[model samples]
Target chain A: MLADQQFLRIPGPSPIPPSVQLAMGKPMIGHRDQQAKSLIKQLSPKLKPIFGTEEDVIILTASGTAALEMAVVNTVAPGDEVLVLVTGAFGDRFVKICQAYGIKVHRLDTPWGEAINPQLVEAYIKQNPSLKGVFATYCETSTGVLNPVKELAAVVQQFSNALFIVDGVSCIGAVPVKMDAWGIDILVTGSQKAFMLPAGLAFVAASKRAWNRMESNSTPRFYLDLLRYRNSMQNDTTPFTPALSLLFGLEQVLRLFETEGMENVFTRHKLMMQMIREAFKAHHIELLTPEDAASPTVTAVKPTDFQVEALRQTLKKEFQLTIAGGQQQLKNQIFRIGHMGYCSPADVLQTISVIEVALVRIGKQLELGKGVEAAQRIYLS
Target chain B: MLADQQFLRIPGPSPIPPSVQLAMGKPMIGHRDQQAKSLIKQLSPKLKPIFGTEEDVIILTASGTAALEMAVVNTVAPGDEVLVLVTGAFGDRFVKICQAYGIKVHRLDTPWGEAINPQLVEAYIKQNPSLKGVFATYCETSTGVLNPVKELAAVVQQFSNALFIVDGVSCIGAVPVKMDAWGIDILVTGSQKAFMLPAGLAFVAASKRAWNRMESNSTPRFYLDLLRYRNSMQNDTTPFTPALSLLFGLEQVLRLFETEGMENVFTRHKLMMQMIREAFKAHHIELLTPEDAASPTVTAVKPTDFQVEALRQTLKKEFQLTIAGGQQQLKNQIFRIGHMGYCSPADVLQTISVIEVALVRIGKQLELGKGVEAAQRIYLS
Candidate 1:
């Protein structure tokens, strides 16, 4: 293996494409310069289709967690009740943010590897008549589960008027999210995921109703305030200094998105996910997430027959492929493979072949080409 | 000028060094990967001397404004009183953050072009012994005034038990801070300023006394919570995803600091400031800041000789160099030249030469090379 050629296959940050790297390496510009403002002006409209919303996507120079906090703080106040649908770690993040802000949280936790049921969400809304907001995750990176946001939104709207906010950190650009049509009040994502850039910038889009709610929010906030973001967006400037290098990479990433077409990008991610899932099945591995609920960006495998840590170590030591082990409660129980952003089906095939090699090295009894053959068949078909 | 050789001479985002830019372009790694953990471990120790503190500098993936908010929410809560020594726009940022958090702010507004006097802080502390914190800016970026922080800290400690938090966003690494020695409870800075990197990461260091106060504070916060950052630092990880590209740049930046030596770095900044200030005097232009209180990182020029906008426009259109215009109330009133981070006396001389050319173009009468000669004298002497 080349000295610096490791395959980073975590939910995020995804690998930086060569062009994006060069874009990020471009010389820094003044945050207030016209060139910078023009970059923002161009990025605003270009970013909308990815979230599938006409609302101005406010770019924040913060991690995905900060974006989640911004979403919560802008929409709700202390003493207001909110329901958080805990699909996995990221969903739990919303709960923590709400509790931190003194918002009364009612949690609906699904099984670790399963998405929240829509009917259950409606039932929770029925029970809690005064919930100010409902929070969820689009793709739980920890469990590799893709929640049915559209169906969930429909059920939520039918039962109550709580603002529907989704954390789409792992799957926003890789999957189709119709924020307006599906009635998502706020959608948040980060650059390091399917946006194919480094971590720094978080993109958040809020519906008109959410903004209306935020106008009256009394929570203590300064930097994470969405109204400040909105006011600055009107002038094509950031409320504070932005990460210019990442914004440069974002321009290139958006260009790439436009070239590939959003639909094709989603299709590519879907294909990669399917290939990896099928490969795991061929190797007699159980998936953490149900196949129907599998994330298009990441796959979590629970190897019942062998040690998950051993396989991950072998992959790293021999193949230079770094995949994520389980987080929090799922630690040491499963391994996750990320196939989002600049990743492809061909990349998935290579990963499968490498996994096959590492599996045998880890004392797993397996037919040599079984997994690779399964993945190839899926890719070609 | 070459196609992309524009000089960014703003308070921030400052011009990035070429090596730092390339380092930032390094391949993305998983946030949980050992490589990333090791990177954090290496960065943590290397960063301390810049703040002149043995205390761990918590790096947050957000702008400087977020860092200020983090500082405020960590040590104080709603209904708590604080004294904000408003030197300029950035000092006002602390007041805004305090007000946003429902903290009662007693403002001590210095004249825009002048630094806060230490006596004023002692007077405020005497009157408001119930103050939970005292906020001050080390270098007011807008008016280019460097407040006497060491004296201010001494006065605050002598008179009050309130936490002394300083915003050093525009001038931390470029100058001698001596945070621990000076008894500062908290010192905050950002990446794009004296750190010689892109705008994203914010560095904050706190005293033991500040941590103790935070333990008793009842502020509701999550993403900007310093305790979470402190907890994650023990394991060499971030509470949230870090700006990985910028961290990579930070590695290179640390190496640069090691090679140059921190004392030399401060002296370089000092010399650059003197050179630029002398150059401005040679042109008979008035400075916004007093000679002793002028910031080493940035210099604001209040010119009665020519139009500020015309000179700035000429610099951009003819020379491809960007000097910052005034911010907020100072907007269109003064032109500011940034001379921090990767900047040198030679760069300042070049800037002086460009300003001379632009001045001639913008209907100003001047002897050519006079400003450049003045800067050269200061550099050689």
Candidate 2:
């Protein structure tokens, strides 16, 4: 039975490298020790280069959602209006968080499988000049569409006072977003995605502009407050006890990212995306997002006359392949393949082979080896 | 040059066991997958026996402080009166968090090395009938004092509306905390301390009565919100991406605890504490906390004439031992020796040997081989 368990084929927690795992296995250190303070201080500078921003980055002992909440509560006060572009599920979550906090939200909703037009976002901002912040996802994990954050940032940059916060949770290391150069104020990322670690901690880079806004904002924040983090980071320690094991894992993973220049890392992600796209084309499957808007991380494929649910179930049951399904109403209509951290050409080939086999079992018309052959060609030549 | 890193000897992250380290290296699984859902569902029931509570225990991908915020914000509202019994730094932090949220705090401050008098605590509660919550720490890691939570909870029980919240971050699995039997309402623990894993996740158990208070509370909580955790726990998932690696480690560690019976775990901790106390006493050093109030997790020792800072530094330089220093004004006044987590009687002996060397270096009168001999008498016999 495929039930004995196989490798993780989902985007993350990606198959951890043996070295990273070994380092994580190292005995824990006290969070307040001088040795830990030295590690944390050294870590902040190393992360600054990956973020491409000179701003201070704070690591929190929570997931990406906690980091996102830190930005939202810090930049936008209780009564302020925030413009969120909902191109996927993560974007919709930003709206939900805002509503939960009693903040006025202006949603710029696009179709689930498409990217939002930057001009429309700019127009909305112009209409609502009093907007305190604009929120967008760099790579919408749900639809596998990359929002035009660089262009959107330009529109919000003109306001100067309004903050541009991007949820780079899924895109930070795999893609490039020059935080200061693009006028982005707050950028939040999680370790599970591109950073190639198990999901736990979130990294945030806040500009002085965002901190200025946080000075006057009061929504009763204690745990998610960025000011406390900013203050504690100066002393080279967290305000509270941190998840030491995950931090240990992250330190090694980030070191690997540094060893391989960030540009090379992004280039590798793009290559993986190109290889997947070529294989999908060979299989006669339609990709959800347009070529220019497609993310370099995950790809969503619309099903043909094939029974998508049966094919997905067969892959899991027979081949032990774990892929993602569309969320909400799109579930079962599309299956997504992830190519983020710790993924390689072999992983892609194996996934494609399983998909072809599952499709054949479900009575779908497909050449058995076409997708794998196409992916191999891209990998080798 | 003592440049290369040595093992961490502070309280936590206590050196992780080899088995626990290997457990963390496993690949990730989608939190929503049936397999993952089943794993989480299984994990919850296993935690109930360890927590000594019939109530549901919620897991958060955060440090110990995050769990504290979850219990505080969820149970106490604005303008609510909270009676905080402070014995050390962590207890002081609880008061600071309460004040930050505009909650009226009545601080019953005891000396750093002294435990709270249950009679005084009860008298204060009787004096302030409007108190909504009573906050205390089970083991004050900063000063090595263990407050009598059961006796204090008895007093808080007299006030029907007052909820008992305990920060068992440093003491949980290493000591006995009977949640239901002791009438504790909200109990929180961190993964790094006593659990013998690296820090990154917090485990919180809330009573049904505490959840009822949350339903009517008007605190602005989203990430640290217990309501969201309670809602999602019903389905065996968290509202956000949890630190999956830490969870993997936690799952294995909890199983280990169950295999060795909870009572056995408590006995081991008590034995280690007794060994440490005896070793220090043989060296003619005094423990900072009273004998009856000493925490089973860590021991705070005060030297007769040596500067605590110099002795601590010398131990690190000469021997690779890492002990904690006094907090705030207590700095250089005392050095803390932690004997929790993966520590054993042997580990305690090694630490005592280092302390003995440091004491001799400081020209204190001490017989050769006295400390180790005393520890062996308590442990080996």
Candidate 3:
């Protein structure tokens, strides 16, 4: 193992790019300075494109979970009914946040490692005509399943007036999300994921419908209050002291997105997803999420021939490459690989080759070069 | 003007030491990695001396405001009667956060430029006898007044069983805070102030008395939940993704505090505060706070002969130096000089000299070198 390098391959808190690192390390500046105001003004418009919305994107110095709480507390009041589509762990968080605030939740659970069916959502919406809000996760990080957010959004709008909110924390920057065009009322994401920065900042963009609900809704809140953020953005700054270093890193991350072009960035993620999935298939590994429901950001694999922990330990102990194991119930049953944010197709190839060697070392029957060759062929295509 | 250099003399977002800056710029690491756990384990104990507490100091990936919110929601439920001592703008924020969460606030407002009288607090505690919590600010950044928290704690402990929570945002590290021995139930601080880092992380240390209160409280909170943080610290990690870059900076900051022992560090801040106050006295400028009430971290000065805005502009334009003007009601009426964390005796002298020059340029009657000479005498003494 190399002494100086650690390959961070988690789904979120992904690898930070070099230029973004340099930006974060720059000397601190006054948050109220004209330069800070300029950074704030430039950031909102630049971020709108990634969110696929023309609405102002509110910047918060908080974790992605705070953004999820903001979504719950701002629009829906306590005792109000809402529907939560639970595909995985992140979606369940919405249920918890809502229930914590006394919002009655009508939860619909999809099988693990599978996407939510849009027809089921339509049926729920039809049954609960008075549901004030509908929550969904765009990319479920736990099971590596990408739900059809557009289809689900269409279903909500067609059947009911419930405001549609999507937690896009794991895939907003890597995928195409038309929040404005698709009638997604509110979309939330964090910097640690695809923004290629540390985990201190979260972004939220809201439709006018969401804002109207917030104004009329009298949920008691302070820090997670979105209207305070909206009022501060009018002056081109944050309501409280901002995370200046993260903002510095965000400026550079935005430049990276622009330089690559949003379309190209999306294409790269899709390509890496294809390469890794094809490689896993060649190794005869049991994939957790079916190919049709797989998320482009992360993929789950179940190794039946050898212990999953043994394979993971071998990879970490030998190559210093880290992959996440399944969370909660999936623990000891499946291992997950994250290939998003600052990740690349080259990283995918390198990871598959290392896994192939690791499998052989763990006494699993596997051809050493087969996985690498499969990924390479897909990369060339 | 030098295009590359700017002296940030503001109270917060302070000038980072070179070592802390370099530490923050280090490459990213996984939040769930063994190294990350090691970091979390190291940070809490090192922070105990700063808070003067034996309890675990919870690290949060948020601005200081979130810590304040956490203090409110965790211990006191809505409709619980609490006494908030409003010494300045920050104290008013406590009132707002309380009222927002439907907590019944019995606010006591002190004059803007003076500290709260302990006698008044003792009397109020005797009258109410049943307040569930008493909130106070250690350093009022808005007015540069240092509240006598030790005395306040004594009063709270003597008369009532109310939990005592302190907002030590601006002065916890520069001064002294004994959360445990002082009978303080909770103390909150932000990294941007005396921690010598960027504004992404906030720390909170709580007494067992406060935790007992939280165990029975039913206020709804998710993101700023203190119990989740306490549980996660047991596992040597944050419940959510942490601000890894800021943690890197904090490790370096702890080293700085240790290298210059805690007592010596406090003495340095005392010296800076004395030097600046004596300099202002030499210039015959008006000081807003009484000598006994002045904060070691920041001092507010009101200039009657010259516009505060003009002096601030002259300093910025001529020397690229930035100091804060008064906030809210005192805006354009006073200017503040901050001398804490990463600041030195040399910086105080340089700042005094620059202000002397700026005073003369702004057509105020001030002899050159008078302020600098006065500060020099204090340093030598």
Candidate 4:
């Protein structure tokens, strides 16, 4: 059902801007060349404001999971006790990665579709005084819950021994994350999410404390080694041959962000999320996350009278709007609409209109244009 | 100096063809869609003949070094004895990766710019009867030496317990490597080299014996896990979200190879290597690799009268030809000419002409048109 004019409404790998694509299509350059070094120099400073950090950001040629793995390997060694605050699938994956490295994980489990409580995390930290680090997710893409990362970081800071690592893979750009202001130790993101690029490059920013931990950590790592990255970054390049095309795309993406102004970018995503949420409410649909915990990047809605899979297929086949379904345990119960990168007000209206028509065709007994009108109200306001 | 019209002649990231670039610029698709599955299906079979293997080839969204790491993590656990045949920098990297994973490595050290002796590897295998795996490189990109993979595979097969892993990152497509016929257990390659695509995707093919060893190995690995790939491959997709744009580029690259005919592709590379070598000889330049062990993909020539770095700079600044300098210990000692992937007879001629002009400009005593005439002779013959 994919075509030239199709709307990609997935949680990650949002629609790439034309400029980004054009930049990626440019001629290839050797990674160690002066041109590549200039690219690294151009992109490194530009990424700091987006991550809200003054520390050095490392660019890795890998997916988001790889960045998370790098964070784990670099900060904590084997037999180190870490706290994994699990809100959704991504947080569970963080637990899995730590467990794979022989790190003892104390899992703080919250139910699916809910955000982790900062008070509970604080209580756990107070009880477990020897915790080496704590892993949390800024936005749980699987359930569309954006956790209270600022409050959590504050709680972790109250106890200075435990480093705070945030998996900001899905919300770093679209949502406002002040990594330094919130005392986040290590924040990780990927190119596919809000970066408007293909899925290859991963960005990780570490504070002075995280770097100190990495200096003495005895984890056996080679390819995902952060110390090597720190060394190569001094020369304005990566330790390995970088994914050059993606880096090219990233330069244009960062330029686009700067031109648009980061504040406006975040505001636009918040407006899109508002429009989608209002449209869902107008149709009498139930959202998976509470209104306070909903992510600004994606919205998950539970299908009441219609099968989620059938509705998803109808939207894709009929309207050419490709959205995401629920993951893991949430599958078949909910469908998600993504309005992250490269999304505009017009895209939101069109997406809502298509969904309304699809729901009507599937005998959901919803009046046509109700969703669109609700979304247009947000746009007008 | 990396302008739009400049020629990129790096050893790994060889020039990308226009068709591949055009394919990469197509509208993005979700990695979990049917289109992505079809892409996997299309590319999997096409890659087999190129790798000269009939086994299951796993596509990973990482650098070639990650694929080498995957081979190590999947087959050998901690305390497992492995033999690494070091011919150049890439072979030394293999040894480092194994050591990082806590594998006991018995290194067979060969001098730089030289090929590993199969007899020495055979002797090491005979002495280390309990070796779990043996790692080697097909073409050492660092030294431009093409090891005798077929003969080495034969030697490794004689010791049936050890899995033979080949780093074919820079040589698989340009040279003739029959993975099955040569009894190679694991062959790894990257997308940037002879695939005529950007650097991101890596392909690793494993024979049944290697798979058997991987099933019982206890090394802790998550992201580079091969079993996850094997499971997802049943549905013709990757376990993780793949680098979609690179895969799009790969489809076109595979078609280009098919259109050119695989044998003709190999012959074309052989002809380019011959042209460059003959040109080097006519200019009285000294080559780093012995004539018999030279790679058909790259030529590493030691500077005689001219400094290697100075010559490389002249070629870049004056001729817009981006060649490679030596890596690691060979730095500033040798310059390499890459003729892999989209390189053609005309490209070879242009490169040779430019090198001849640069050598003359650098105060080296070389007759005008001599190198081009030697290359033309090889091209016409």
C-alpha displacement of A48 in model 3, angstroms? 0.5
Give the per-residue lDDT of model 4 (tens digit) for A10-30.
898887876788899788998
In the range B306-380, model 3's lDDT, one tens digit per residue, is 999999998897666899999889999999998888776656766776677677777887655556556656765
Estimate the lDDT of model 1.
0.87
What lDDT tens digits, residue by residue, belong to model 2 across residues A1-381? 201234455555565655677777778899999988988888888888778789888898898998888889888877888899899889998998999899999899999889889888878888888888899999999889988888888989985357999999988888988888888899999988788788888999987788888898888899888889889999999998988888888788877786667787787788778878887898788888888998888888887787667877777765556778888867878888888877654455546655665676777776554665566456545
A-chain TM-score per prediction? Answer: 0.99, 0.96, 0.99, 0.98
Quantify all predictions' global Cα lDDT against the true fold: 0.87, 0.81, 0.87, 0.86
For each prediction in turn, the share of the native Cα contacts (below 8 Å between chains A and B) that it retains comes to 0.00, 0.00, 0.00, 0.00
Ten-residue region with minimum lDDT total, candidate 1 chain B = B1-10
Highest-lDDT candidate: 3
Task: Return the TM-score for candidate 4, rounded to 2 decimals.
Answer: 0.52
DockQ of each: 0.01, 0.01, 0.01, 0.01
Query: For model 1, how does the per-residue alpha-carbon lDDT over A245-327 read when each residue is reduced to its tens digit?
Result: 99999998888888778898888888888888888888778999888899999999988889888988988876568899999
- What level of docking quality does candidate 2 show? incorrect
User: Can you write out model 3's per-residue Cα lDDT over A1-381, one digit (the tens) per residue?
Assistant: 112235677797898876787788788899999999999989999999899899999999999999999998899999999999998889899999999999999999999899999999999899999999999999999999999999998999899999999999999998999998899999999999878889999999999999989998889999999999999999999999999999999999998888778897888888888988988898788899998898889999987878889988987875667999988888999999989888766466557766766777778876554665566557556
TM-score of each prediction = 0.52, 0.51, 0.52, 0.52
